[model samples]
Target: MALRESPESPTPRRPVSPAPVELASPAPTRHGTAALVSAAAGVLLAVLWSFEFVDSVIGDTVANNLLGHDAKATAIGGTGAGLLFAFVSGFAGTFTACNIAMVASVGPLSQAGASNRLRHHLRSLLRPVGWLALGMVAVSATYGAVGVLIGDGLPQLSTDTVGGMPVRLIQSSVVFGVIGLVLALLGLSALGLVPDVFARRPVARVVLIGALIGGFLIGRPYPLFNKLFHWAVETGNPVYGAAAFTLQSLGNIVIVTLLFVVVVLVTRGGFLRWMTDPARSALVTGTLLVALGVFTVVYWDLRVPSIFGVGWFPTMPYN
Candidate 1:
């Protein structure tokens, strides 16, 4: 016999519906991506500028080597010569391995944005670039003062007989070779051709990288810079040393700004998107750097002309 249904009879209930899966939002648009990249680029630039500026103060080697004139002599020759030397050295330094790497690294950062009209794109870059410049100047001044203190406190080394000409030439060649190797590795990494260990970009550790570059400049004393430093130290005027280096740094700033502006303008046209591509940009940058390194070694180190006398690389007239 069927049992009578109880008031609270157990009954099969309808199946419970499964919870809906939530979807992630779509990836950021190119414009949004560009904006984010630009912001990051600005921060990177600020950090690099700050560190390099300090390094400039600490070393001043590149300035002295490239200028090939005593700061005092220039000052006596006329403020014009001093200023010109400062500007020339600063501008020329931008082409060095570390500096060129800095420039190439920015390409990926700038590529994220939408292609605006050339005028508008440049306008957008101006503010960030201006901030970068200001950061450099501010940091340079602070560090320049510190450099002066260090210069005054340290026992001066005699430049007159530091080494024979042959020894110095060999030393310079070895230094350039090492720098060329470093640049070559950097270029390969930028191209993504190297192992992941070496391919790390500049975004996260830019400060550290900049510091390393600065340290390198400081530790390696070239003949010209050594001579200049000796002259400044003998005078017993830290101001002269500080001013000379500071002016040189300012010269670098001017060229760097101009170059950056040109990059922004050229890239804005979108004709060079390959330059901004994560992989491709690396390739191009790496190629250029490798070429630069090779050229430095062959031309500057060997003191040889390019094939067919083409003058593919620049050689310092003073050298």
Candidate 2:
């Protein structure tokens, strides 16, 4: 009995375990990410397209007419033409050549599981983009100044206005040719499927040469470029303008496609991972893009009044 009782006596013991550690997680992707990117991209495209139109038309006119008749004046009027040339030369030229930026800023938010990689890509592109932006502004400013000057003077676009035959003639002819080339190239480039080596590197050279050639073509028959210009301006319908803008933006879409590849290469995993977690991805993407859209409006509000000397858009000011 005693032995059985002793053997039966056993003690109850508890097992110990370590506490789980918590980590800070990224925000979830909400459903609105794609919409936000699309919207923001649309706005950006609109702004860029407006400038491009000006650049394509005006730059061609001025550079072409630098040795010819005052076709630039006839084609676009005075300040309008100046603005146009400025748009093409400054905004048009670079905008088409360098839209990888949108992808840099937005691709991470759009793609899945690639936030960190996207960020790195963006960082790599930042310097180039900033330089491009700065160059665009400078070129735009120069184009504007020249346009304004010529607008006031109504200088006959030819070698005499630009310089001598050796340098000026060659330069002017080259400019016209180049612009024509860019317009033609733009038609194809707008498809946006070109390889990066071609897209990023070759485009600038192409545009430079094309600008000269295109400028010559448009200058030769200022009436032709003007017809398109007239169509664009005669229509007060903002929708038509917007449509035109959208059509023009097809180039941007192509440019963006090229950049998208770069973004994909750069932002490898984070974006995809984020995409898997749609909730947080949407939230981040939506919030940032919406903010960017709002900022665009605000920027337009501040900029238009100062530049245009009026307040036309209180609602959708940027458009």
Candidate 3:
């Protein structure tokens, strides 16, 4: 045993294995790109629509007042100064109660699930958003057609009297009053102050409510579109009238869509969670609607001049 120590003896060594290689974590999937794109498109359309609406308002006013009811004047003036006004109005509309309510209602639905993939989320959202857009377009176009008809018939009926009131004046007042009432009721319902009749069928009721509200928002009398429709009818150019309202509707669609996108982004699913509380939704929506309704009434009934204003409101021709 003592003789085993030798210079050539190698020390025993344990086998060393290579260190385990760590593969990079799988790349995270991007989500919500499509929704973002859609929102951008909606913003663009809204701007365009708002611009056109402003143009119609200013152009009609100038043409009817300054240029002696000339269609040529309207086209020129509206296309010129209208662009500036439209931008202002469009920007202003973003902060309105009706618009805010619409955003609150639709924003939650625009969200895709918690999936990390962008495409998957987009696929989920596309159908609902597309259907909403399509519905808006259909309703808007119908409003346009109605405007055209109203414009065409106004001139013939302007001189006609109903119960000692000008047919036009009567028509304007009644329409305005009725719409204001409807808006107020809608607001009340949203606040949960009204009965639960509309709550029974939430989906259909919401869509129908949106359509009615949208119709009033886009095609209200005393606005430029109404005047433009009249001018178009006088000139036998119904296309102009139709285009104006349709474009405005498109603008509304864009605004709503963009709002939905913003809310979804900001809340990050919290809005969806919150929206599940119907009572809360109703309260918020009702408050906004009430404000809008009151504003509508004041603007149309109180501010609008009874005799000198153009459009559906009865007015003496400016000499």
The best candidate in terms of lDDT? 3
lDDT: worst 10-residue window of model 1? 204-213
lDDT of 1: 0.44
Clashing pairs in 1: 34-112, 34-113, 190-282, 191-282
The residue-by-residue lDDT of candidate 3 on 244-263, one tens digit each, is: 54555545455666666566
lDDT of 1 by residue, 79-125 (tens): 45544654555555554423443343243233322233445665555
lDDT of each: 0.44, 0.35, 0.46
Using Cα atoms with residue i matched to residue i, what is each candidate's TM-score against the true structure? 0.47, 0.29, 0.52
Better model by TM-score, 2 or 3?
Answer: 3
Evaluated with TM-score, which candidate comes out highest? Answer: 3
lDDT of 2 by residue, 1-319 (tens): 3545466677665876778777534321223334345446544543443433444455445445542544344455443443343233322222322221222224222422233434555454443333333323333333323433343232223324322222232332344334423332332222232222233342242323222322222222123332333444444343333333232223223344346446545655344445545444434434433333333333333333323434343333423
Name model 3 segments beyond 4 Å from true: 1-136, 146-151, 155-170, 217-219, 230-244, 302-319
RMSD of every candidate to native, in Å, equals 12.4, 18.1, 18.4
**Candidates sorted on lDDT, descending:** 3, 1, 2
Q: Give the true-structure RMSD of model 1.
A: 12.4
